[model samples]
Target: MSDVNLATIDLNLLNVVATVLAERSATKAAVKLYVTQSAVSNAMKRAREVFGDPLVVRESYGLTPTTRGAELLPALRAWLEEARRLVAKAPVFDPRTSTRTFTVACSDAVAIALLQPVLRLLKKWAPSTRLRLLTLDRLIAGDGLARGEVDLLIGIPPVMPPGLEAELVYRDPLECIVRRDHPQVRSKLTLSLYASLPHVDLALFGDIDDTIDRALARHGKAREVAVALPHFSSIPLAVLETDCVATISSRIARAFAARMPLKVLEPPLALEPIEIRQVWHRRSETDAAVGFLRSLVREAAG
Candidate 1:
């Protein structure tokens, strides 16, 4: 009926009025609110001024809602209940019962080295949890992690993008892999022999294959790469079928050697170890579900 200054209103007055209407008596409402009856009467007077309604009336029985109070009670009760739920504490993660889908982006090497143990742990602990994997692409990886399209990123990037946090999972040194019955290679690789053999070059990260070429160029030698593959998983099979030697990571090389007729040999020249790390946006730092998945990845790496 008139303009009111909402800033001057006390929300506790509404709670008092609602309680009084429910209890049907100031004395009883005051007891329920842990306040004196005078406080309840004062609250009802302020509520009448705010709402412009005689919210309740004394009756022969006890107290009865006026026509306006009847219309307001249901709405007030619903609003208060919703407000309570809005501020309620979040529920803890229960892996066995939760059917959450976690997304991860990584290279084929990481998938080969870590996915098995991660799957085993998931099966035992969180059977219903599903895993979605994406092939690593650096162009959109940082943005994907920031926007939450990708849950976790596991890779060997030289540096993480801004606003992302990373932790080292493990380091795997470079090694030479060839078929077990290779013609020229035997127990170990010498610089001259390694340079002469046809190579299967792996280019997972952009220009990453250049590291080997650069290292070789320093010694006034170069590798003759017969074929270049984009993924480490492809190198083992290619090497197994031909006389090609692939300079590959130790973990994937050893893994392939166990299953296929491949040999993992130490390289003659020094190569830097691949530092694999897991990265995430700081926004998910406190998310229990994402934390659970991150823990599983660390366990798998170990």
Candidate 2:
């Protein structure tokens, strides 16, 4: 045989040959391959010229493969099968066996309210997988996602970074937290009483451009921020020690209330609930592992 140069050959002709041989009729092969009967005939003509053989011959009842055609059948089918496997979509992610370490970026408060539950679900479903939680910075969040530094972003940024896709995980309503035995506060809080008390603010970012303050400003009222802490974990403890009342997310407030001697009460101001979203770059649109992680987060949020 002469040297078989792949660059000069139409591999599609081989598929035509395999189909014709299997079906034992050009008409049947045409139906299977979704092509006209003439197309199948033309493909056979080209194949005959390339291999220099009458690859198939017509018999009494139907078409029959020649010795050369029979030899080509197995090889052609094997190549087609391998080609299909090569072009197929990615396999489904198996959380039970996956060792993928997903990185999520969000505020410390979000980690407390959201990730704590996510961690429990992961522990049960994806025992081998790992999690890396990074502090959120809205300014650099988009870049981090594009760079593949973080797999997911979850938090309430005043402005979401452009070019990323987001879905609402849940809304976190604001609530006021104080020591259980706060002197001035009882069952209900009035706007005037709320403004009169000292406040303990949790500043995720260094600057304290908070929603609570903005809401208070709309009502022509303001509270004295006795202390501003950068971490969410410290706010509950700070409230426990002093008479300062902190307005925080209802999720975090109730969570801390269950453990500490803290009281969770509705905030006096009509502040909008914080929208927590799960964000990711469009590049990971079809990534199985990332999709699995997102599903777990959705479950946790619910």
Candidate 3:
């Protein structure tokens, strides 16, 4: 059922109704529109009659929009924004002046490899923008993207969720990292030696869908996991003090080895490389801010 009475309604009152509901006061809406308060009050009366409801009500401090009024907000805002954009000259996204918050999801390994460098670029170029980095949890990430809770996702996903798009940005091979002083790994790390050594399994994330385990199982061999912990940053320190070797992406291993006493060796088993990607929802494909953030990520990865 609809309450639209076409004969007596003035279409322009819709703007007045939106403005009144937004400002929560007829006087404020009139001031914003540079019109008299009485004019706005009359317009509001006609708008209420047209809609057959009191769209806004007087509370103690201010007026509040009713449920029907609240429901109209998004479409009304979009319509008003489109109207403004139509009259504006040369609309473009200026990141330097935009105070936007961008969200990114990735594995701890990817964060260890790329987060700092990407933050450096963002701080230098888009000073006012903020970045929120969350660890990748595939189970809920797809829902987050759909609900606009997540902005961009980086790293390998077992499968791309529907309504999402991705671009492969880089690849890193799996490698075994060990302390330089490890007694048994003097020359060529052999499969028998690797299986014999204690292993540090990355267990920071809840799900344990590991490629290393799958690769090992394929060859009918299993490595003993001496310890399991979260965070790739701590893996180096963990391996430094123990006889355990950690299997991780080569880039993360290189980054850690460059700063610490760690050695990167190709994993004895033929484990597939990790493919890093930047993923976003299809609905955000044409958004300028999202485009800018994606470019920044691609540049940092490159």
- Candidate with best lDDT: 2
State the number of backbone clashes in model 3.
1
Ranking by lDDT: 2, 1, 3
The count of residue-pair clashes in candidate 1 stands at 0
Compute each candidate's TM-score over C-alphas.
0.80, 0.69, 0.70
The digit string of per-residue lDDT tens for model 2 on 222-270 reads 8899989999999998999899999888999999999999889988779
Better of 2 and 3 by lDDT: 2
| Candidate-wise lDDT, in order | 0.87, 0.88, 0.84
Better of 1 and 3 by TM-score: 1
* Candidate 1 accuracy as TM-score: 0.80
The digit string of per-residue lDDT tens for model 1 on 11-130 reads 888788889888999999999999999999989999999888989999988889999988888888987898889998868889998898988988889999999999999998899999
CA RMSD for every model?
3.7, 7.5, 9.0
In model 3, the worst 10-residue window by lDDT is 204-213
Cα lDDT tens digits, model 3, 130-247, are: 9988766652645778888888888877678699999988988878899999988875688888888998877766444466777777878777888787777888998999999998
lDDT of 1 at 123: 94
The deviation in Å at residue 206 for candidate 2 is: 1.3
Give me candidate 2's TM-score against the actual structure. Answer: 0.69
